[model samples]
Target: MKKAEEVRRLERDRIKNNIVVTSTDAKGKSHEDIIHAEQIGTKIITSELENTAGKERVMKNKHKQLQERIFINNKLTWEEREKRKKMKQRMEEEKKKGRTANMGYQKITIDGKQWK
Candidate 1:
């Protein structure tokens, strides 16, 4: 009985250590509230990643527009610029949304908590 209980305790610890939990407050605020023994390697944070990616996208767009206005726009006629811009806008609107068929998370929930 003692050995079996010890084994179960250890397994529980292992599982707890492998999981991370986040919490949110009522005023639309969120934070990572719990993590049991921290993992050895890098952990990819979803919100931080999205924020960084958004900033990068804005910077890239600004640079592209600047380059186009400084170089390409000067050489092209007004009609040509509007044509290219309209075509890009149409293609952007037609772009696909959401994930591919096979994309998913391999996570599971335990007692209302998520585990990866």
Candidate 2:
């Protein structure tokens, strides 16, 4: 009988010193009431996950925008389109040649004297 009363007293003390917190998520999902001490940790983890998900969503949206831009910008008259295509091909060729050629820096002449 004495041990039972002591256990009851301890349980009451524990409940009195602790708190239960309940939260709802963005999706209208309700979470179970958790101990107050754990609430901060739970919120931190939830925010981290939400932050990463937001970053991924933004990246996907940017990629979609880039694809749309490329398509829309390429829509032009045949002459203009062909001109742009040729310009792009020339740029690619220049890039390839630049990668293979290592032309050292040329001396810059200023006031009839070569500058370092």
Candidate 3:
């Protein structure tokens, strides 16, 4: 029974250290509050974990807009597609050269028409 109590105390300490709470006061200052294990629920911990996982998934798919423009939108001509490919290659080369990578798609103008 003493060993079980000791294990529970250790687990509670771990939980207390892990649970973080952030709030904004009326003066617009941000404050971070660490929650104790006694004030936290299993649902809160699971939801926070899920929220973090969701953010990572979103970051992984940050190129969804470009993908949609290239694959889903069939309005682009072959020449425009080739230009976009070249731009992407140039961006990759710049990254390899230790330059800042440009992730924004360049606006392509062909014959007074603008295509993003």
Best by lDDT: 3
Q: Across residues 16-56, which tens digit of lDDT does each residue of candidate 1 receive?
A: 22222122311212324322222222421112212334334
lDDT of each: 0.34, 0.35, 0.40
Ordered from best to worst TM-score, the candidate numbers read: 3, 2, 1
Quote model 1's TM-score.
0.21
Candidates 2 and 3 compared by lDDT, better number: 3
**What clash pairs does model 3 have?**
none
Which portions of model 1 miss their true places by more than 4 Å? 1-74, 97-116
TM-score of each: 0.21, 0.25, 0.28
How many clashes does each candidate structure show, in the order listed?
Answer: 0, 0, 0
Q: Which runs of model 2 end up more than 4 angstroms from their true locations?
A: 1-64, 67-71, 99-116
lDDT of 2 at 99: 34
Clashes of 2: 0
* Residue-wise C-alpha lDDT for candidate 2, range 1-116, written one tens digit per residue: 99977876766444432322223321212323222223343322121112334334433444453433321111133343455566555545655766332211232333344432
